[model samples]
Target: MNAEGKAGGFAPGVAKAEGALRALFPETPLQENDYLSKKTGARVFLKREDLTPVRSYKLRGAFNFFRKAIAGGATDGTFVCASAGNHAQGFAYVCRHFGRRGIVFMPVTTPQQKIDKTRIFGGDFVEIRLVGDFFDDCYRAAHVFAAESGGMMVPPFDHPDIIEGQATVALEIARQMHGESDARIGDSLVILPVGGGGLASGVTCYLRESGEPTEFAFAEPAGAASLQQALVEDRPVRLAQVDNFVDGAAVAEIGAEPFSHLQDFDARAVHLVPENRLCATMIEMLNIEGVVLEPAGALAIDALKNYAPETLRGRTVVAVVSGGNFDFERLPDVKERALRFEGLKKYFIFRFPQRPGALRDFLDLLGPEDDITRFEYLKKSARNFGSVLIGIETRNRANFDVLTQRFDKAGWAYQDITENDTIAGFII
Candidate 1:
């Protein structure tokens, strides 16, 4: 069946929401990228949602939510939301714009950059409270605060109004693609990053409802594959643990409301991007295109690597760049991760003899291209031997193979701890 036939009833509401959004900000540009196109053999276009006034498409939903709430005679004029990243900034911006008092509950672990930006956007109109270390913790706190304080809770996702707001991105995409002439929505592939599933569900539902024959793909952080797990279990389930490295998209659970819209999608349509690999994409975009992208912003672009050239060749592909609220303070960590993922850097723990020539013997085993980046004598495990922590960097990945071979031949007592998160976390 055609998309419009199945989702026709949903299209008009999305279109209406899109029309309302114009009063707030102009449509974000959809630019065709030569770099990505050349790499993937596709006519790659980036829907620059990162260029939104709040540096993410999140404000669209928040604005729509506030508009509907006010129109519905919500006289309290108070709003509450929980977010550790883009959603909090969007909610704060909307609250300020509407001149309504707002309370934002963010995780205590949220980056200072996000916290400061949220405060700046809201100004005196919003109050930010640091709750627990993860989003779910703050989310529960926000709910309790909303009920006790008689405030309307504006969820990051999982609400009809928020979904409608986010669907406006699809409306804009359709119109923009039509104007491009060479890009046809019917023949395009749209890649969206999934967090709580708001952006992905909204964009997919809208395009489907419009009866466009557009194909959809989703990108999710590998450490927080909530949407993928949901598809597998046939329901939303909270993860026992979540890695917040990709803090913007590190949702522990997919929202039930968003999952209802996304449940029918095939599991193959989703790509889980490794957190370290995502760092490489972020670095690539920054260095090559001079584009700054947050981890979540790079998710869709990074997922393009998972597609075979044959699948994307001759097709127009649209990947949403979700946000660019990256803090410069995190650059060192990003570069470190990128190097590790690219196999150009590694850490090792070595047991070295305390004799005079022991250090010289180890240094002699290194390849010409390999450079020592770190060396520290951890402790003397025995009277004649000491534990040494070493970090190495090389221009090529093959250098590590050669170096390891040399170590094995020389009978060096060393353990490669690069992949040991537990050990690395404690010392490296």
Candidate 2:
């Protein structure tokens, strides 16, 4: 059993991964991030695996797995796998590369944007099977197809070869950091986002075995801190609930193989980045730095706030930006979350009088920089008053204080529903 992170030994697979992956694609960039270095007081380098052909590092693992399968002289009848996003895309691309028939099983609910991209990448070489409404249905369908057709299922990250392939990211980082020499990279820290644990585990093991004293920090979306929970318990534990907002890095449980390599680490070191805060970082990168990062991809960048400047000063650090499978349709929500987290927006339910100029009175309270984005009348709660939903946006977060002060002076009865999840979920 290729236990998570190849507990018994993994150097073999990691060693071969470097060569096997080159045929599929070149090594992604290891960029010196001037913006991040200035922010964190560290010599920050970004292992830009997201710049791969598929815009994700998953291609390395997928290619390695396929190469190993064929190298072992396994019959290439059909290759089956279940995935809706990056994994499926990587699998399809690799299958096409090898001239092998590939069947990709994706949930029926997969975004059309993803489906179209996968089809475009694979062309006629791949056939996508839209299975049940959820992931379980898709997984079961893939397994059944594999069994009936004598095909092999390519797992996302649960295999030894996948782990080794994922480790190629680290290898590439090491190679890119040097000036085309046999000189090894000095001690550095690698900050990686943990989802299925494939990338984190593979990179960690490969660096350790390479005899590099690289410090490692694992980042997980707060809504899906599976690694953190598992480490604290000293056992692999499944989350009772998970938020799929950061779909790329939201896993209910870290892979068994990944757990083996990461089990010894302290739980505190596993930073849980708030999804909304990550959205803020995403917008900041897009607007200020022109870096487009998906929710999970921003995990490492968002986590920078947690580490003190002194802790990172003068040290070379690398962050693995995992994938960029962001669906733009979610951008509005992302923006709203970002605004809320950054304190630039707020929502309130106001009880205003039905008398004339009541609306003007409320409007008068808004500062010069404040803009009312949403205003709706729900119903009359009393003969003299009605309930209204109000959303306000401002250039400065402090504008809310002035707005609230005006409300208090004007005898306005209001409930702050910006953070009222029940109301926001139903109405907003």
- lDDT (Cα atoms) of all candidates against the true structure: 0.90, 0.86
RMSD of 2: 2.5
Winning candidate number (TM-score): 1
Error of 1 at 51 (Å): 0.6
lDDT measured at residue 79 in model 2 versus the true structure, 0 to 100: 89
Clashes of each: 2, 3
Question: Which one is best on lDDT?
Answer: 1
- lDDT by residue (302-407, candidate 1, tens digit) is 9999988898899899999999989889999999999999999999999989999888888888888899999998999999999999999999999999999999
Off by over 4 Å in 2: 1-9, 180-186
Clashing pairs in 2: 4-256, 4-257, 5-257
Candidate 2 lDDT score at position 167 = 88
Question: Could you tell me the lDDT of residue 125 within candidate 2?
Answer: 86
Candidate 1 shows a clash count of 2
Residue 257 miss distance in model 2 (angstroms): 1.4
Candidate 2 on 1-428: residue-level lDDT in tens? 34323564666666567876777677787778898888888888887777888999889889988887887886558888999889999999998899888999999999999999899878898999899998879999999989998999999987778888898888778778775353235567788999989899888887887787778898999989999999999888899999989988888888998898889899988989988899999998888888888898889888888888888898788788998778889999999999999999999999889998888877888889999899998899999999999999999998888889889998989999888778998888
